[model samples]
Target: MNQPLHLMTPEVRANPYPLYAELRRRPVCQVEPGGMWAVSRYDDVVTVLKDARRFSSAGLGQSFRPPWLEHNPTADSLVMKDPPDHTRLRTMLSRAFSGSALSRWESSIRAIAEELAEATVRRQEVDFVAEFAMPLPARVLNLFYGLEPSMALRLKRWADDLVSIPASQPSPQRMEEIRHSLAEMERCFNALIEARRASPGEDLVSELIRTEALTHEELLGFLFGLVPAGVETTVYLLANTMYVLSEHPREMERVRDNPALIPRLVEEVLRYEPPGQSSLRLTTEDVELSGVTIPRGAIVIALMGAAMRDESRFPQADRFIIDREAQSNLAFGHGPHFCLGAMLARMEARLGLEALFSRIRGFSLQRRDFAWSQSIIARGPLTLPLHLEPSRR
Candidate 1:
């Protein structure tokens, strides 16, 4: 038997594509540490995503509520629910991202993007992640929720610790930090929910409260789940877009010359170096996939990174072709649980890139060596230093 893949290892976290390719050959097999099944092929991954009956989303809750961690709000969030419950939660939250709502926020989003991009380029040489990528989403989220600026850094720390739990083998010190962060998040969000209840405003929290659809616990779960889902994913998306463009100057020039292609570029980046690498699922019953029978109650991970690169689905699957015909990819997931923040993430990327390339002629990586986020579920550089060339026009 082949040695099971240890996904959390530093090397794999940095670049797992080569190993992903090897796994695709087997298509469905067990991975180590937890003996979870990894579904790597495009068809099989989609099969797992679409068939919520046979492959349940409860695996998310299982993954989140480990023995060491306390009961996480995410364990009961919409992402972990099945059928009627998931549908109800999704309905309550859908209005916030509706067309009119996004239209209202578009100008603000662009303004923030332009301001941050201008500041980053003014530096000429900087860690792109810190100066631009991280702040764009963080600021956007803060504004959307009407959160105080004082809470931004604390919220980010809590989110980082929360999302990293499933992926990290935390030391005692790290465990304490994670626990404390969780407690702090619970306290902060509870207060926010109550404040909105007493006197609502035009912000998302107030908007949700006006609906009067979700219970207090449900509201807490939704807000708790939103931080990591909303902020970290977009941070990675923006950073990965820059990393891809920096490495492929021709594509960068193409996009800079024709800004209309920015959306396409973002789409291709989502397929090529997706922020969320996999979706967690549980086998509700014995399920046969790729000729392998997975037992009931098994943890199955749909490898989005591998599926997006599956040769059968995408031509020149490994190449970063920005104009590759706009076929669907599992970067933001699919079916009932498709990322609710898809529009917001795409809008931020499009505007962020427009703000960036409009000011800078081009950019190149200052150093080839960099660290990737330690979380197995997310992918992107922790620090991306770049030498940016200002636009001459």
Candidate 2:
């Protein structure tokens, strides 16, 4: 048998596609350290995501409830539940992310993007991830929940700790940090929930409170999951978009010349270098995929990064093609648990890129080698230094 893929290694975390390609050949193979099964092919990954009965989402709950985190809200959130529980929870929260609801924030989102873009370009050289990518979504989320700007720093730190939990074994200090973040997040959200109960407002938290569909704990769980889901994913998306444009000058010119192409560019970037790398699932029955039999009760990983670049599904899967034929990608996940904030994420990326491109002629990477985020589940530059050129117009 081939050596099991060591997913948590720094090299694999940095650039996993080559290893994913090798695993895709087998389609269903063992991932080491934990001895979990990995599903790498597009069809196989979809099957695992869609067939929630055969592949239970409770595996996600397991990931969220690590030793250090005694009680992570995500462990009880919708993403970790299967129907009819998942269906019911999803129905309750669906309205918050509906088109009409999101439409209300369009102008606000654009304004935030424009303001941040102007501020970023004024510096000429800055860490794009810190100045632009991180704050755009963080601010938008604050607006959504009616949070104070002062709370953003804490939210960012909590989000970082939350997502980093499953990446690797945390050191004692890191473990303590994660525990502290969880406690602080719970305390903060508890206050917000009570405040919303006392006097509801126009924000989503108030709306959710008005519905009375979720219990206090459920509400807290949903908000806890939202910090990382709503903020960090979009942060990675925006940062990845900038990184892609810097590397592909022609694509950057294409976008600069015609801003309408920004949406297409975003889609392509999602497929090319998605913010999320993989999702975890557990098998409820003996499952046979691509001629390999995975026993019941085994942990399965849906390798989205590999599946998005499946040679059969996407031609020239390695290259960054701005105008690739439009098709669904697993960047936002698939099936019943499809990312609830996908619309918001896409909008943030679109407007964020538009705001930046309109003000800057172009941008180039200040350094060729940069650090990637530590999370194995998500992928993006930790700090992207860029030198921006102001538009002549």
Candidate 3:
């Protein structure tokens, strides 16, 4: 009985690395009852991602939901298109999300982090996921789009529903829920796009609206995609990092003392436990990977979480070492389809963690009982209870 790591079994959700290790030992071949191949080894996953000519980013259908859904919002997303189309959409959005553009939000991100940390410090114990991890990204994205924080929260909810559609076995009820979410999202973003067009401001939506390359549908798709791509992923990354730090007090102390180590710690956390575990790609032509022949027109699942732990790629890959000399992890992905919100996520984590640890001296989990989110493509606890020891300083 082969237990595929991509499944959402309770045991796999709790700890999937052992399962991934089992899968990594086999040749890169089909694991799904269907023909979807699981590419787990580090080199092979990189190959699938880099060789876009052979493996297309699209055609797997939006969010891996039922391919026949009429209300699929991600079909026109930049991550779901081939070159020329993908390149054009990415280029226009790139100007809007450029490093310089994102850097301007650093102070605002820090402020949000500080505010959230201050709020948490006053509580005896808090659900960190709800209080800090989730809201920071939502609020930051809200600030980016000039939306009120209230609207940002609603957007996060819609994004969560959108992204979760792929991980579950689809049903009519689920499809209806997805349609509802998409309608609300479209309504929200359309109004925002209109507002940005009337008076372009120093915001992401305005920058995107000002771009000549994107159509209205394309713009809506990008905005719709941003919530899941930006908010949900960031929430998990931050929550996972906090969980990791709690497990390693010594590393936390070191990072708190020297801020320089925070960046490396962030990278290590990404490698050790990426929020997004796997991404789907469609094969455009017959390809040979790891001596296994993958036929054309098949779906290939790039197991990024598994690849990060491949022993050949990172010595002691299973262990989480903050100062590992080789820091080439695929947490933010690689090749042309690398994550668009990678920089923004990193900034939030750094600022969020820094503000968190600095304010609360001795941080620890309040309870051992926690519930992990069930999904094939993402991993993290649904709620993390935490307690902050009084400041020593």
Local distance difference test values of all predictions, in order: 0.88, 0.89, 0.83
**lDDT per residue (tens digit) for residues 228-248 in model 2:** 888888999999988988889
Tell me the RMSD of model 3 versus the true structure.
2.0
Estimate the TM-score for candidate 1.
Answer: 0.96
Candidate 3 TM-score, true structure as reference: 0.94
Q: 340-379, model 3: which lDDT tens digit per residue?
A: 8888889999999888878767788877679887777778
Better of 1 and 2 by TM-score: 2
Report the lDDT tens digits of candidate 1 across residue range 1-393.
788887778889888899899999889999965898999999998889998899898666866788998678878887888988888899989989987888889998899999998899999999998899888888888887788866766767777887887756789999898888888888888988889889999889999999999999998888888888988999999999989888798999999999999999999999999999998888989999989999999989899999999999999999999878879999999888999999999999999999998998888899978999987688999999999999887
Predicted structure 1: lDDT: 0.88
Which scores higher on lDDT, 1 or 3?
1
Clashes of each: 0, 0, 0
Worst 10 residues of 3 by lDDT: 60-69
Taking every candidate in turn, the Cα RMSD to the unseen true structure, in Å, is 1.5, 1.3, 2.0
Overall local distance difference test of candidate 3: 0.83
Native-to-model Cα distance after best TM-score fit, residue 72 in candidate 3, in Å? 2.8
- The residue pairs found clashing in candidate 2 are none
